[model samples]
Target chain A: MKAAWSAEWLKLRRSRVPWMTVLAISVGAAAGGLFMFISLHPGRAGDLGLLGAKAQLSTLEPSWPSFFGLLAQITAVGGVIIFGITVVWMFGREFADHTAKDLLALPTHRAAIVAAKFAAATVWCLLLAVYLTAAGLGIGLLLGIPGPLTVPVAAAGVGRIFVTAVLTIAITTLFGLAASVGRGYLPGVAVLFAVVFTAQIVAALGYGAWFPFSVPAMHAGLTGADGPSPVGYAAVGAMAFVAVTATIGWWQRADHTG
Target chain B: MAVVQVAGLVKHYGAVKAVDGASLTVAAGEIYALLGLNGAGKTTTIRTLLGMIRPTAGSVRLFGTPVTADARSLWGRVGYLVETPAAYPELTVTENLTLMARLKHLPAAAVGNVVEQLGLRPYAARRARELSLGNQQRLALAKALLGRPELLVLDEPANGLDPAGVTEIRQLLKTLAAQGTTILLSSHILAEVAKLATRIGIIHAGRMVTEIAAADLPHHVARALRVRCHDQDTAARILRQGGYQPLSNLDGMLSMTDERAVWHPDEVATLLVESGCPPVHLAVAEEDLETLFLRLTARGAGA
Candidate 1:
């Protein structure tokens, strides 16, 4: 497992996609800063035109908590796409590049290789979460949000953002399984879009708390309809367990002739 | 000692039988080649031997250990390259080898050794996408060579190599086998396989049609003695009376495929000379491996 982890991390470190995800999350945080600016001065929104129209879509306040909420919301929503790509790239590249056969018939167990991919993804996604929070803090300080940015406040924000990131990352793993079963980038991306669309429909139908895919967005108060109940988080955990296990089992047992 | 033992291996995908009852035993230090046409189940058989696909029936074992078992350690001594050469296009040649070495639990130094072994040292720092098709193949071979595996399974190992590169790979496999490494490679280049393989197993339409030893290949090849004469009808009857089954060939010549006739063309000449139908031309024509392979595979296809 350690050897697999070393190899997986080396691959992730050299890849451009991980860094691209960071930039994506950073851009999301910067956009959050813009939303906060419009919330502080609503009249300036009209003068800003399209940027203002985009800012007005987010109902934020000039406060640390509102800024944190905005960042979490972006992660909950954008993380599904960005982090899903991270997981998808990790598993799908093997097939897309036709290198999966090499990993099989190796001294290292296939499950170890899968686990190593998940571990590397977890670490990178966690860093993306932390970076998003820090970027939010920097953007807020430069814009001068209303609340004082104390160490405790910052800690609390980090905790909340990390929790949201974790929930989002958990479900992103389903895309990894999809990529494995589908054997390429496009299928995994298709499943991701389906999950995202289904989550929205399920959440809109007022059962968001029960669907695991909708839990993270609800937890982040994407609609301010309601925060997810504890059951929703548990459901997310169950779904994550299933995805990870099924993926490992698929790697171990599935016919890999192609 | 047998290094690879595959018995009654069968793999079926829905209605299509990719491989059926294919069996072979490869002894240690033997360069065995699996010869086949397109879609002859060569790849499927190789994948089953590597445990990438579970057989619908039969068994495959390496070093007396069942390949079907969850024997992770069993692969520590085995190395294989199936199908086309693939690599992480983003990673350099050295990095790609290091990644595989790590997965195999090999020492870091193994990377450099294989790079040198495969003549990839000059391209060590180049990204895989930047290398030519032949160099990419070299990198794949380098990865397979990592850990000094005792058994090597390669499918079309010379796919992208030049003529010189093909010769180099042939010599490398010969040297590797000479040092006690068992190699099982599949190739369509009949001439190359004739030069490299100690034994050849021809698979056609998911069946093992025949297995032939390199030394005995000449005997398997069809040889016919041909005779041309002015009085062809008289010569044919004379050869028939002389205890030879003679048949007329398309190019105005009488030919006999009997082993005795081929072995003693002198007797056929002497008989024709005494029978007033002396031969103008009498020479033995032999089929090459390509033609023999085609005939054998065509026979297997019917079966």
Candidate 2:
């Protein structure tokens, strides 16, 4: 297991997608900052109405720190996109380039490879999430917001973000495994999107966000005052169970031919 | 004891049987070559042996132990290079090796030795994508050799290699074999196989048709001697009367075969010279691997 983990870490280090994700998150955060500045100091509301209602109304009080918080939420979505690409490339590239044959040829168990990749993807997502959260807090504080940033609030925020990132990674890893085993690209992305979209709809209907798909969104939506509901925990648990089972099954049964 | 043993291995893709009841053994310190045409189940057999694919019916044992559900433990003693070298395009050549070494849990000092040995030091810092195809192959080779595995399974190790690269790989394989590393290599390149393999197994349409020793190949493979005589008509008549089967006329050279006895080129030359029929040169046309392989596979396909 240690060797597998080490191997997984090496794979992630060699991959470029993680750095690209970091760039995307940083860019999103910067754009959020710009939007906040423009909304607060708008020359004219009539001229800037085209941006969005959020931008127009964002001028009320217009605390730069709060704007950073909003950007953090939006950038969290970028984390998902990054997770998607990482998931796709990690599993898909093995089949795309036919390296799975070489990988499977290693004196490792079939299940270990799958588990290692999942662990790697989850850790990558978590790391990125923490970075984004810290970046948001730093930018918020730097921009001179009003409220004192308590350690508990920041810690709670980071914890939720971590959970959300893990859930997203788990869901996407299954998609990746499916894509790899199925030997295709678009199908995996489509399935992942479908699951996420369905979960969003279910959560919006005043239902519990405890479904496997809803965990990421729930994590993203929960702020300092909005702790996780009992249903959210159930949803995360169920999804995790499904993800582990599906990954193991797919790795064991799917063809590892290059 | 055999280092690796495969028994009645079978794998099917829908209606097509990829590896049909194939079995072979590799003793320690032996270089075994699995020779076959495309889709002849050579790759499938190798994959099954590595436990990359689950066989429909059969069992594989490595070093006297049945392959476990978690195969990672077995990987420590094994090195494998698939048909095409697979490396991380985003990583520099050295980074790729370093990562593999770390994964294999090798001593920190051994990494540099492998890099230098594979001639990858110059390209150490170049991203894998930046390297040429041949360089990528070199990196792959370096990765496989990182920990000096006890068993090495190479699939088409010389594919896409220039003559120099091919020679280098051949020399490397021979050196490893000399060092007592058990190697299972599969390739369509017969000459390379002939030069490196101590034992050869021919697979035709998902089944191993024959296993032969490299030294004993000429004796077991049936071929003919082409005898050129001073008079074609006299030679043809005499050969017919002597119960030899006439093959083809290569321009002016006449080909004949006598399967009843082992062909001695020197004896045939002496006999032809004495018969007043060998005024010109005489040569023995023993079956090369290409011909033998074609015959074995063609016969299997026909059946």
Candidate 3:
């Protein structure tokens, strides 16, 4: 397992996909800062043109809580696409590069390889989440939004954002499974888009709490703060477990013809 | 003990039977070459043996242990390069080899030794994607040789290699065999296989058509004596009178496969000369591997 982990880590670090994902999350954080900038000084709306005019309609208060909520919302939505790519690449690249066959007969267990892949994906996704949070903090401080920015509020806000990121990351285990079964990134990326679209429809129909994909978005206040119940979080956990188990099971048992 | 024992193995993917009732044993220290055309199930059989594909029937045993993905302990003794070799395109050659060495539980120094052994020291710092096809092949061979595995399963290890590289790998395989490392490989290069393998298995349409020792290949090849004489009719008559069955091919040359005729072609010439039909061309020809392979595979196909 250690060997597999080391190899997986080395592969992940050398890939450009991680850097691409980091760039994506940083861009999202920068956009979040721009929105805060517009909201903080709506008096200059006419001077800044259409974007500023649009920002004039902002309902979010110029406060730390709102800033954190905006960051969480970005992660919940954008993170799925970015982090989903990470998981997909982690599993899909083996097949795309024609390397899966070499892995199948290794002395190390297949489950260990699968576990190591997921471990690398999790760490990678978490790093992006951390980057988004840190960038959001930097942007907020630079904008100098009103409010004390109390430690308790900051901690709570960061905690909530991370929880949302973790939940979003958890659900992406299914994308790994999809990539393995479908034998490339296309299927996993297709699944990601389909799930994202369906989650929006389902959540808009008032079933966000029950839908695992929507639960994270709702809890992050993309929907209202009357967010997911404990049952929703449990459902997310259950779905994550099922996805992880099913992915490992597929790796262990499937005839790896690729 | 045999290094590999495959018994009545069958693998069917949907309606196609990729491998049907194939069986062979590769004893320790012997280079067993599986020869086949494309889609003849050679790759499928190798996959089944490595547990990369589950057999629909029969079983494979390596070193007397049944092969399964769970047979982790059994795998430590084996190294395999199936189909085309693959490596992380983004990683350097050294990094890729080091990763494999780690996976194989070999010392970190094994990477450097294999790189040197495969003549890849200059390319060690190059990314895998940047290497040419032949260099990629050498890198694959290098990975397989790491830790000096007790058994090597290579599929077309000579693919993409230039003549020199091919000779180098052939010698490498020979050295490994001499050191008691059992090798089971598949290649379409019959000439090379004839030179390297101790035994060869010809597979056709998912079945093992024949297994013959490399040393006995010449014996198995069909040999015939061709006689073209001044008077072919008289030569045939004299050959028939001499109790030798003579058959004429489309080229109008009288040919005889009878052991008596092939073993004593001088007797046929003497008989023909005495009967007023002196031979113009009389020579014995033995079948080469290509001819034998074609004949056997065509026969198998017809059957």
Candidate 4:
């Protein structure tokens, strides 16, 4: 398992996947700041030719708490897409590059290979989450919003953002399984997009609490004021279990003809 | 001792049988080639042998141990390259070999050794994506040869290589076999495998049609007696009345493969002459490998 992990780590580090994921989360952080800037000064919406964008900012507050909350919300949606692609590419490239065959007859077990990929992906996604928070902190300081960032408040806000990122990463495991079963990046990406699109519709229908994929976004308050119920967290837990087990089992037992 | 043992192997994708009842045994220190055409189950058989695919029936054992995904220790002495060569395009050649060496539990020096062995030192720092087709194949082979395993299973290892590269690989496999390494390779070229393999197995339409010793291949070659003469119809009938079964080639010339006709063409000439029909062309010829493959594979002719 250690050898397999080292191999996975080297491939992950040498590839463009980490850079791409970092860019995605960094951009999302900056975009959150821009949204806050527009929310704080509504008059600039029209004066800067931003049209009626101010109407959407009516519920937003130009405070540090709000900034952190906004960052958490973006992490929900952005983490799924970015982290999902990272995991997808990790498993799918073996098929896309036609390198899967070489790994099958190795001294290391197939389950060990799958676990190593999961480990590398987990490390990468967590690093991206850290970057998102740091970038958001820098953006918030630059905006100079007048509000409380008391130690407890800051801890709570940052904790919420990290929690959202962890939950989002959990769902991305399904993307890894999809890529392994479907045998390429496009299949897993298709599943990722489908889940992201359906999450909005499911959350809008008031059942986001039960839909695992929508649980993270709703817990981060993507759907207005309502946060996820306890059942939503259970759903996420169930999804992580199922996805991780299926992926490992698939790697161990599937006829990897490709 | 036999290094590989496959028996009654079968694999089916829905209604399509990919490999049905294919069986072969490769002994230690023997260079065995699985000779087959495209879609002849060469890749499927190789995958099953490597435990990359599960067989619907039959079993594969390597070095006296049954092949299974969980038999991790069994793979330490095995190295392989199945189907088309592949590598992490983003990683340099040196990096790729280093990673493989780690997975194989070999010392780091294995990387530099394979790079030098495969003549990849010049391109060590180049990413796999930057390599040409032939060089990519070299990298794959280098990975397979990294730990110097006791057995090597290479499926079409010579694909995309130049003639010189092909000769080089053939010699390398021969040298390895001479040093007690067992090799199971696949190729559709009879002439190519004949030059290297001590034994050959022919497969077609998902079945093993025949297995032959390389030295005895001369006897199994598709040899035929050909006769062309004036009044071709009369000459053919005369040969037929002489208890010889004849068939016409696409060129409208009569041909037969009976041992009597091929070994005693002078008897045919005398018969045609007595019938007052002079021969224009008469000779014994061997068919090309493609034709031989068809004859051996048709209806599992030699199975």
Candidate 1 pairs with clashing backbones = none
In the order shown, the candidates' Cα RMSDs to the true structure are 1.7, 3.8, 1.4, 3.0
Q: In order, what lDDT does every prediction score? A: 0.90, 0.72, 0.90, 0.89
Query: DockQ of each model against the real complex?
Result: 0.80, 0.49, 0.81, 0.76
Candidate 2 docking classification: acceptable
| Predicted structure with the largest TM-score when compared to the true one | 3
Q: For each candidate, how many residue pairs have backbone atoms clashing (under 3 Å)? A: 0, 8, 0, 0
Rank candidates by TM-score, best first: 3, 1, 4, 2
Q: What is the per-residue lDDT of model 1 for residues B260-297, given as tens digits with 9 covering 90 to 100?
A: 99999999999999878889999999998799999889
Runs in model 2 lying further than 4 Å from the true structure: A34-72, A105-116, A138-170, A183-185, A203-210, A218-229, B227-231, B242-253, B259-282
| Docking level of model 1 | high
The sequence of per-residue lDDT tens digits that candidate 3 reaches over residues B1-303 is: 899999999999999999989999999999999999899998998888888889999989999999988888988898888899788999999999999988888899989888988999999999999999999999888988898889999999999999999999999899989999999999876788999999999999999998989998888899999999877888888899899999998999999999999999998888888788899999998888788888878877877
Residue B23, candidate 2: Cα error in Å is 1.4
Task: Classify candidate 3 by CAPRI docking class.
Answer: high
Q: After superposition, how far is residue A228 of candidate 2 from its true place, in Å?
A: 7.7
TM-score of chain A of each: 0.95, 0.80, 0.97, 0.95
Instruction: Return the TM-score for candidate 4, rounded to 2 decimals.
Output: 0.92
iRMS of candidate 3, Å: 0.9
Question: Which is the better candidate, 1 or 2, if ranked by lDDT?
Answer: 1
Badly placed stretches (over 4 Å) of model 3 are A50-57
TM-score of each: 0.97, 0.85, 0.98, 0.92
